[model samples]
Target: MTTTSTDLDAEALDLLRALTGRADAVFHDGQLEAIRALVDDRRRALVVQRTGWGKSAVYFIATLLIRRRGAGPTLLVSPLLALMRDQVAAAARAGVRAAAVNSANAHEWGDVQRQIAQGQVDVLLVSPERLNNPRFRDEQMPELMRTMGMLVVDEAHCISDWGHDFRPDYRRLAELIRTLPGEIPVLATTATANERVVADVEEQLGSGTPVLTIRGSLARASLRLGVLTLPTSRERLGWLLSHLVSLPGSGIIYTLTVSAADDTARLLREAGHEVAAYSGRTDPEEREVLEQRLKTNDLKALVATSALGMGFDKPDLGFVVHLGAPSSPVAYYQQIGRAGRATDNADVLLLPGREDADIWQYFATASMPSESRAKAVLAELSGTPLSTPALEARVDLKRTPLELMLKVLDVDGAVQKVQGGWVSTGLAWRYDRERYERIAAARVAEQDSMLRYESATTCRMQLLQADLDDPAAAPCGRCDICAGVWYPTDVASEAAGRATTALDRVGVEVEPRAQWPAGADRAGVSLTGKIPPEERVESGRALARLTDLGWGTTLREVFAAGSPDAPLSRGLLDGCVRVLKEWPWAERPTAVVAMPSTSHPELVSSLAEALSSVGRLTLLPPLTATGPGSTTGRARGGANSVYRLADVWQAFEVSPSLAEALAGQSGPVLLVDDLVDSRWSLTVAGRALRRAGAPAVLPFALALVG
Candidate 1:
């Protein structure tokens, strides 16, 4: 039921009619009820709903009610210029008086300010970055605030320090809200929020403000979730190209890094697809242009980091693909949510591989420290007057960890900057100790949360929905697990499984008979230039040897010729069947999997050296396996390349019971094997170790043989 302006009581309806139109100013029943409650009862309402669920519309419609009843303008604070412009445009189309203060033009801001002063603007949208401007708060908004009836914060989750797109200036909004007039109602809206985020929003909005925690259901009935696991990053890109962006409707391809976004978009463009790249580093004007292109369907797909969507409304998105895993599930959820808003049959693809986690870990290690190191650093900095940069240099903490520590300090008011350096803002001793302990505790808790989410046994969607207080939550039947892992398989499932097995079978059966193409058998098989296999197979061999090493490694055949059809194709099963029926190496499944282990250790080391020569692969430490059941196998060659796990057991020469005792450790076991003879064997061993109580097992395939 819609409660248009005409539905109000005679007095209110008459006033609304007089101010606007004669008829049909209806509002959604749900929206109107919430609006009335917010205005009459004075609540800090957080309207949590998915995109295209009319969350903003509800708040805007309520603005009219408040305007009819009160004497001030509604101030909408956002952090995206594109969103501000869109909102202003939306208001104009709806025949509402709205203006935005943004960077589209310096001249426009002056006109907006003038409109605010004249009490003619019903809605005002400004970026939070604008709030930092003195003229906005001190001169412009002061007049509007006196006449402001309500404060609406859109995409309010951005204010949360824990939010994926946290803006530091949002912290100042509380003071801005307080400066407004006459018990002004505060309305906040967001498409996504976890429990911690909700609490942060409440805290930011000021205390004792009644918050309407409306957690909409997580199920997007139109969205189909799929997962694709590729053996290499190059293979992953190929999969994305043929599956995700090939579709007709507007889509978003999310990559983990800026370089990935650039490369992915470049590849798509090369393939003659209309695509654009967006990341944090993208210029504001360029970002706006790309976003507008996406909205209008002028661009078919956008390869971007998570910085593209946020408050910008692009409801026509047909699908979203994560070309790589994001830093956290929070980020993944936010990025994927950009799709499937108003469209039917929207698809989301999560490209799977352990490499994603490894990349994330590398970034994590670069920014964060080991638990003991974090503790040591915090303790060293405890009660010490040091600026963030000074502390970073002292403790060797990277930017992210340093920023996180500073935020924690600011939140607790434990440290303050006085001129150049930092100083304890409180009674230095107890405060410093407590803040240090608290930050440590929070860090531990966060780590636990990350682990829990990573290895959660429940339905992923339910777990995500449960993080929010979505009361009507159930398994999203579209997710990987719900669609198969925890439920009976459908025809699609049987077909997909058979397709995978067939592809594997074909690769193994034909690989031996099939020869490497042209000069592919050599050290460096180049479409452009030739180089020695020894130099090309291994890192640091010498780029001078192979000037044009096509973006493929010579050491392994993980993605060999005639790979399965692209991820989205239903015909992959048929394609696999055809390959199995014809390919020469179709009979060599074990050899196909074993090919990487066959490459000489020097080759790998050389490759590693070559990459490192230019600085790529960083070898950490080689963990050796020692157990009663461990035996020494012959090295594939003179180098430390081909020693086997079974061989390691023979060398240890202990009984199975003793081996179990030693290998069944409670923490992560980094098993050193000269060669991973079979991924299947490693899989079995890993499962055994895990079942025997090892938390996790990391297999390091070292090449000891030349």
Candidate 2:
């Protein structure tokens, strides 16, 4: 017999009460509708409600109700580990069993699989990347697709065959859904999807059947959004230093990059605030600990990258301060949604940086798959599967971008990933030129919208909502623009000085390459495995990173495209001198030698000349490239280790005078360059100097390309 609507409501209400631990819990406006669509009608649905609207509840409640009908377990493809943790915990509270298989819990995957086999698990939370795991894809996923009662994709905005989104791998879900039994229900949920994204998702998830799209107001009334245009990073740092404690409660401080997050957290800690840096570089177990600490309000804040964004919950998180604007207004909305979930009010502030556009452009270009790179990768592959490392040797592209392109190509049916590695499917594929261009155009538009959002004076919340295409967009009447500067503006002079000193402190250690990238020999690189200790250059230092908060701005200008080549700026020189003054080398360098640069010859010579003049170290003749590949314009040939090493190997030669100078030197030689990228130039130049008989080589650069 079919379940009645009234009976379904009663069962869903009971599950909701248990899940929320509230005796009188009722569904949000469309939550019950979403559940009924899944459990009753067994239809595919797309949910585009605001973040705190409890999208998880719909899937959890539906899973429980469907399980009561003796259906198989639900398979939840969540985007983040934090989301998985929250879902698993929420399931237990509702007396529904949930298990997870992710990188963090590899040891428990067997137990989770067994639980699922025994009909003990109601929901299985797996990340989108988990779907691509060799074992999971070839072994576990096929079985789950057959047995799973429902498939729910949370944060469905990441699903786009257009090829660039938060998780490009999420496109795999479309294919997975295609293979599922027609009777099984499928649900995709997101709060950030606009009209275009919604259409794309609907097309991907609903191939033949009409998908029920449930969208609610994207506005977050609890969020009082504002923007602060700080002139420099130091001023922004000063603002946070002075005003964090005044914010209502412990909250997140978001940054665009890992370095910024780490730097901001450090500066805040120096000011006596309890905070920690969380990013992709953060260890998996430590990320769990940090998430818990934030949930319990132990740390005053967690300065984080976008890694902490999706579905990480703290009902009372009082504020979110972005040191730099995200790439789009929709992203801004999603991040601010992390705050003010259960509270009547929460602060959302943006400190738009001067480098915001540059940073946005940097990330935007890397994400979209390039047509030429795709062809290059495809050309290098045959019918046989080749490991990623082996392919890296054959292709000039770097590992990360190459992997990302291959994933998109795999989804597009041009390639397939197997147990060994990846193989070309020999299926004729056409590059979606128009689709990629449109996607790029959309990103540009979104970025432009973000710029307007920052400067708009009418209403901050309404502008953000409108950017997300919310029909209910209206003036919040509470933001700094709507109201008048409610947040603290002035940074104390002492705080500014403290921030200046903290952010400006230079000297990033450039660790020497320890081992040659695998498959180097295939590219004609003689080096492989660990470098001989005697031939390796010692750990070196640069004035600062081009992406750093302090001197990075100046260095970026110095090295920006089309910028004129000039001697080192006094500011950078001062920072470099400071690095040298505090240098922790085993012994002071007795000689200074400049690494030849076609890009910034004056800058390199001036740095070497000044350092030697200031320190009274022996000045040695510089080495210059004169071989066949020396005309490769920029010194670094390729991004990957194999190509870079091959391009620079025996590329630079030591002059007689330089060899004589090195032979005469009784101490380490200082090798200065304009910038350090790939580090192959330094390794090659330093090896030449060491062979010519310098006791040690201490490499230094004006900036590191981190």
Candidate 3:
């Protein structure tokens, strides 16, 4: 019972009226009519939509129309197997015969082929990987495509390497679609895209075919964006737990790495929070577990990498937290859109820090190749498939960097992933390994540029929007810096009263002296206290003196103590800054101790060599106890225990305030101990110092002071 265009138009109107309660509602917009004309004129077409837009409706409505006229069927090629299944389920609920081909069953491919050949399946859904099967082309796919009225490519941005979700299999799709008769009317759609992705889709699929660009402005007015920079990830985790405790509803926490996602989930679970995690590495069973849990609201929050956000929509989400920076603006928008779907007033929190920039640089260097390197890899594999070993040998590069180069090539459509190997995509691009390295380096340089943009000191939002070509965007007044902007105020009365306090805080310059300035009273001052003998009081004084001198670099070193190893440990360094910032002013020492690692001949020699290249203040490993006379345990049976103190000092580098307490006292040696059993070693050491007419000797326990 074949029919014509007029018959299809009638059936489409009826189907629309059934869905929306009005017959004429189907074609009221020119968009639908324009899509129909592609089939009417026998031309392939490309359709792109922004997120929250109804691009799916365009194809589904047209499918109803064409099916009524007895067109064979419409087939949807999707990249996400889970999403494909979900879509099929939705179509079936609407009484449409839709089924998806998936890897879940060994017989799915054969079953799909049988169903398609017998005309039992009205709408067939398959992933791009499935399309690469030889059976798809060797059989009657050409006939099936000709009979089909529309060939839909969902989430079309997957074809673009510049897109957040780049799929290598999508590059082969252009060849597959071209094999179909009259080049089946192709409709590709997604919720997100920049100019680059949109162009890639048209060039790859429609190939100059009519492109209907239906742009939608679906900005949710109730959403608020905020950013917080913290000193450590642990502190950020604490803040996250606090946010979750107060906010009710489902939330998504986006992490940059798999370890972060797993660790966050475990940490949240230990805190009595129900959380699920998703990533590319999740096993099939685990993915099923999480998917079911998420759908039923059994999980209150989901900590996931970007891999989880494609088609899982749970409209009740309350917020999105970016634990790391997204790769690009498109990615950021898509991840954040997961929230506020079924609720109003959704909020997004971005926690940015210096660490994120460095992490991104690491990724940029490791994951992507220089453009020239990518080109060179493609050149080596030109005209034939090559195993990884052969490719590596031909490229003459190490396995890891070479593998990464191939991946970047796959993303760029210059190569294709075949079974157990890869082959050039016949794109005619050529380059050597050197060129690829150069290109990869250039890409990293671009990422550095983006880091600079994020750290800009002014107009963050304006700069971001302008980069995206959205200049009309207004300043988000709720941002941290914007909220703190100040205006003139009538505070002359209050200002006069605080002049002395301000002056005291700024301090005064004086010649090096032993005591505080004459007028600077020590009443209520906590800084001047007795100091310990063995403790390095000069190191603490040097730290304070450096701070007084406004040397920002010394703040991290003097207060923050690290083992000679792990110099970049942010926890230890920031903790050091915390101690110095809290030091009381009256405790200032004129002659500070310089216990710089230089005091140790062995350690200083290594440090000197490293400093020649890395600059001063090299963090080195602890000096292990060895040699016949080396002290490993408590000094002199624990009395005035320098061993325990030295160990703690070596590991944590904490300088007890007891050192500062004993400052400026010209007397016998003073000692600080956590515990002591005997007085022999302390008496002997004290006597030896006094025999030499040293300053007075005293002993104090850190535990007692603590």
Clashes of each: 52, 0, 30
Clashing residue pairs found in predicted model 2: none
Task: Decide which is better by TM-score, 1 or 2.
Answer: 2
lDDT of 3: 0.52
Residue 182 displacement (Å), model 1: 5.8
Q: What stretches of model 3 exceed 4 Å from their correct place?
A: 1-44, 135-146, 177-180, 365-429, 432-706
lDDT by residue (1-706, candidate 3, tens digit) is: 6557687567656655565555566553445664565456555555544343445556666665556556777888887756765677656654467877667654777777687778777778878766654455446466666677678888777776555543556766776666666645667777666566667677777665556655434344445556666554545566666556555566788887675676667667766788977888898668867866876778887889877777666666777888767756556666777776656566677765434554454455444445555665777787677787666545424465676566556645677767657887787544446744654654454455455445656544444444333425456564434454221212233333332222122211211112221111122222222323432111111111211112212222322335242232343233323433444434321111111222123332332233223322222222221231122222222112222222222222213332443343453232222222222223323333333333443322111110
Cα error, residue 311 of model 3, in Å, equals: 2.3
What TM-score should be assigned to candidate 3? Answer: 0.59
Candidate number with greatest lDDT: 2
Give the TM-scores of the predictions, in the order they appear.
0.58, 0.97, 0.59
The number of the candidate with the highest TM-score is 2
Q: Is candidate 1 or candidate 3 better by lDDT?
A: 1
